[model samples]
Target: MGLLMFYEYLSRIEALIEKHDDIGLHNYLDAMHAADIAEVLENLESDEQRQVFGLLTDEKATEVLEELNSDDFSELIKALTYEKKVTLLDLMSQDDIVDKLNELPESRQKEIIAFLDYEDAADVKDLLLYEEDTAGGIMTKDYVSIQKDYSIYYAIETLRAIAPDAETIYYIYVVDDAERLVGVISLRELIIASPNRSVESVMNENVITVNINDDQEEVARIVSKYDLLAVPVVDNGNVMHGIITIDDVLDVIEEEATEDIYKFAGTSDEEVYEHDDTLFDRVKNSVRSRLPWLVITIFGGLLSAKVLASYQTTISANASLAMFMPLLAGMGGNVGTQSSTITVRNIATHMIEGADILRTLIHEISVGMLVGMFCAIIVGTAALFMHAEYHIAIIVGISMCANMVTAATIGTIVPLIFKRIGVDPAVASAPFITTTIDLTGLTIYFTLATMMIANL
Candidate 1:
């Protein structure tokens, strides 16, 4: 349905729930997709969310809970009764089950674990052992696999038996006698091929797999780079453990994007709209993320102050120099930030490798020089019009050109340096780049001002 129609439908559902005060309203809400239901719940107040969620069937509740963001998921979990929580946990997939458990307190997790079925409990425990941002944590153990010795007919029959629980049936894995992943076959191939054909004969042996300990970001990169639907996970023994589906990789991509944005804005990785967090808790999370950058900016400001102080006598003699200082610094900062952002993004996407780093830096420096020369002409002409001394205009022009070159070089280099040191370039780039530009711009401006004005 169109968005307008969906909104109208939700409005009608809200009115119906208010008017009827019955189970029919609950049934009407349950019939919608989980994503749609999540949207509806998000629009409601906290108390209203609790009330609506309480009325949902356990299955519907599980679907909606998974669809919600982490903050909303925590709130929903808190709102649910102990029995309802157990029911929701039982209904969710193993990966989701572990996610919810990790979000809860240790005592709550222990209590929930006691109620889980042995198989599910074991899977959850195994998943919890891996880092939250690793391949093992994101992969689902539920997938259709068969021995390579099995004929197409046998594989199809086996798949049909377990299709209900599998996350996807697009790719069927073929395992050797040792239960090692040997090959992969698509559902389309299975349906087209003769029934008697052995899986080993038909399957593609050049299977792409990842180690269970691989970083989730690396997993997402591989999936996106190869345009893969799913990637197999293997242990040290090369035994197939689980598969990471495209949907899970998409979640990783989103999480990475959110993290990058937060780092860019000098915020923490925690949810910004946490419902139960106290004001102090919120402040603590935000402050910790922001303070380091603020500290760095302070040092940058200090450097600018020192540079200006060194040229105080010259600036006092020639007032025009002070007017252009702000303009020069601002432009340099803008150019630096732009270069840093581009380089960081390229590195993150794996488009730029370590080997290409020097070449990229040199290219950026050359581009900066060209841009600086153009900006210098404009600023110099403006300075000439504003000031009587031709030497002062030339000083301003030379400083502008030098500042731009410095800005671009520092901007491009900072991110590369961070990446080499195993730091996320995005997180380290912005504040440092701006700070470097500010300091360098001021130094250039003041030195030029001192040279021209002192001579005059």
Candidate 2:
């Protein structure tokens, strides 16, 4: 639905551009939603983007500019004139303006800051003081809050006055005499209650709130856990600063998912899927994030080599052992990776809690056991035919069972241990699990072969 709407709008935008110069184009673009315009702008070439942007009203241009990804925002800022940039900055929300400013170089950011209105500039400065991945960084200072003493009638009128500027009015926070957050009331309740009822009487005291210092991922987890529309943010004194809305939480979720995916693939979180970034810049980002992981994996491989070399005599005496080595190691790695992936994802999403970690481990172990038993039967039968030795069959079956069980156990435990140590479980689990399984599988294969086959 959104794509179709955007395509229809883009066709209209294109037709308008053909018929009219910048001024007329600007008028048409100003009438569209910021999100729709952003979609269209992103689809256009650089030259086309400049042309379309030239046609937009200052406010509309800023809205669409702020809606773009960081890479696109940086590009758009470079294309615009100093005067136009100042005008766009003036029109954007303080939070959005700060975000854009943060993406620019120091000199560019200083120049833009100089052009901002003193009050707006201060808000941006304060927001920029926090780390980018905190509740303080993403929140807006434009949320609706009312004194607890106001009657529902007065509150309604106040909401009407501020509704245009506020990002969301779903939950109106109630602050006390010292500006400390005391309670909250939903817009639905406010509308349904008696007009004369005081906000203090109607509001619920048990408000869910997050501190400014809380991690953005933690903020997202809280919002998702409580199924909240918006969560208030407060300082140590309980003074209301801003509220993190569902929209912001959604953005956090996307960012966290992107970060985890990049980490898994040995890439950086900053690598975005936009054309605005240069090839060299992309490669720089990729290499910086990936090289360390590759180096670590190299060491892991060396460890595996040392383990295999330690059993050189076993492999020399029975060259057939070398044939099944790759098979056993490969299967174990696959199973370990599968378990770790599921466990890490479940833990990150909060679907699996700390208390349930043991249960999840047991469940995964059961799955691994079933899988191992099935594979052991198949491989054991195959070994009986190929080697015509009952001892080789027993050795293969026992090795398979042991390796699978070990893989499953390592896969389940590694992520949990990473979580316990305050490391991102997803980032550390996969490689570690695969390495452990490789070492354990090779040891089991050789040890079982030595004991069982030598007796036969």
Candidate 3:
């Protein structure tokens, strides 16, 4: 259903709750999908969330909880007793449980870990050894594996026993006696193949896998490129560790994208907005997030101001020249922003390489020249209509063209240089690029005005 429909349904449920209709609320929640339930939980008050959650069965509740984001999950779980938390933890996938536990303090993490069964605790401990942004950190241990020597019938039976608890059984992995990944067979192949055929004979040996220490973005790229349901994580010796499912990759994609967006806007990762945070909290966070960037931008503005001040003599002689300053600077900023944004996106997606950087910059500068010519004509016409001196018209037009060309060149090169030096291109944001252009554009405008108008 669309967001509107979901909100409408939530309103009806909220009215029922207000009327003390437990049966109605329970029935409503029971009928909703886990994702929908999670959405409702996100918007509800603390007590309301707990009340709604209580109506769900253990299995359904587990699914709903898993659908919630980290903040929502922590808040909802805080209302549960230790025993209830333990029950819920047991029902979750190992990777998800690890993620949830990692968000808590060390004492709380230990408390949560103690509730798991010995084997589960051990698995979680092993997973916690990896950094949160690595393949091993997010890869679930709940994948079905069978011996390569097993017959199709035996593999099928093995799947039946494990499918109840396994996160994904679509691709059954075949490992050697040493527990090293040897091949993989899809569930369709296992079901349709001759019952007595050996797993080794049917499995595809050329399996694509990621190292346990691989970055999550790299893992996401590999999965996207291969169109995989899950990719196995392996050690140096090809010992299968765990499998990163498509769902985990989706989470990583969202996280990385959000982080990049925040960085582009000149903020830290913690500044990403949350729907549930209080108004005060949001305002406080926004101020904190924006202040650092604002400070840097202000410094850039001061430098531009200094350049303008240095051209005071020329401005005093021809006050009309100052009138065109904003136009030239604004056009330069717009052009630079457009060029840099595209370059940054391409670099992020691995579409731009070091070899392509020069070609990309040249193309952008060429585009700038064409765009600049049109802008200069428009601005020059407007200046002439304002009854400005012919020299003023000529200087303003030339300044606009030159500023735009310089803006495009600088914008293209700055991002590529950042990428080459291992800096995120997204960090070179519009504000930063615009500030740079402003200073340069102003200097060019004043210098040209001084020379052209002096002769007139």
Candidate with top TM-score is: 3
lDDT by residue (199-305, candidate 3, tens digit) is 99999999999999999999999999899999999999999999999999999999989888887777867665678578888778888987877888999999988
Models 1 onward score TM values of 0.91, 0.88, 0.93
lDDT (Cα atoms) of all candidates against the true structure:
0.83, 0.82, 0.88
Looking at candidate 2, what is the lDDT of residue 256? 93
Model 1 segments more than 4 A misplaced: 1-14, 42-51, 54-59, 69-90, 453-456
lDDT (10s digit) by residue, model 1, range 56-155? 8787888888777655777788677788777787778777767766777777777667767788788778888888899998988878889999989988
For model 3, the stretches where C-alpha displacement exceeds 4 angstroms are 1-3, 71-86, 273-280, 454-456
The RMSD (Cα, Å) of candidate 2 is: 3.2
Off by over 4 Å in 2: 1-33, 39-47, 57-59, 71-91, 270-274, 351-354
Q: Which consecutive 10 residues in model 3 have the weakest lDDT in total?
A: 268-277
Error of 3 at 441 (Å): 1.0
Leading candidate by lDDT = 3
